[model samples]
Target: MSLANHLEELQRKHGDIERQIDIALSHPSIDDLEIVDLKRRKLAIKDEIEKLKASPTTH
Candidate 1:
């Protein structure tokens, strides 16, 4: 896949994770660890996006 396409996918994943976190927060029975894991995954995706954006690319 192209770098642009990959980046777009990562962004989509980040957004999805954010939504998951929101939904998870709404339920009192949800495990805190699960939420934390989701947040970490989101942050990791965000970091990857930033790294890709920071580097000069044709995309």
Candidate 2:
């Protein structure tokens, strides 16, 4: 797939993670470790998106 398509997929995953985080937070029995892992994954995806955006060919 092209860089643009890859970026879009990553963004969609990131949004899905955000939704999961929200749902987890809404639960009274949510595990803190799980939430932290989810947040870390989300940040990683965001960082990747930024790196892709910064690539010369992406422009």
Candidate 3:
């Protein structure tokens, strides 16, 4: 797959993770660890997207 496609997928995954975080927060038993992990994943994906945007593309 192209790098742009990969970045798009990562962006979608980040959106899903954000939603999951919101849902987790609403629950009475908030999984703090899970929330933190998801946030970390989101940040990682964001960083990846940024890198993809900055990098030059062939096509």
Candidate 4:
């Protein structure tokens, strides 16, 4: 896939993670560790998106 497509997909995943985190926060039954993991995954995806945006390549 092209870089733009990849970035778009990453952004979608990040948004989905955000929604999951929100849902997890709303429910007391959700485990703390699960929320933490979701946050970590979200952060990682954000970092990746930033990295891709900063890169010079168009691919």
Clashes of 4: 0
For every candidate, C-alpha RMSD to the true structure in Å: 1.2, 0.5, 1.7, 1.4
Question: Cα deviation in Å at residue 54, candidate 4?
Answer: 0.2
What's the best-to-worst order under TM-score? 2, 4, 1, 3
lDDT of 2 by residue, 10-59 (tens): 99999999999999999979999999999999999999999999999987
lDDT of each: 0.97, 0.97, 0.88, 0.97
lDDT of 3 by residue, 1-59 (tens): 97868978998999999999999989969879988998999899899888888877723
Which numbered prediction scores highest in TM-score against the true structure? 2
lDDT of 1 at 10: 100
- List candidate 3 segments past 4 Å from native: none
User: How much is the lDDT of residue 6 in candidate 2?
Assistant: 99
lDDT digits (tens) for residues 6-38 of candidate 1? 999999999999999999999999999999999
lDDT: the better of candidates 1 and 2 = 2
Q: Per-residue lDDT of 1-59 in model 4, one digit per residue for the tens?
A: 98999999999999999999999999999999999999999999999999999888954
Worst 10 residues of 1 by lDDT: 50-59
In candidate 1, the residue pairs with backbone N, CA or C atoms under 3 Å apart (3 or more residues apart, or in different chains) clash, namely none
Q: If both were scored by TM-score, which would come out higher, candidate 2 or candidate 3?
A: 2
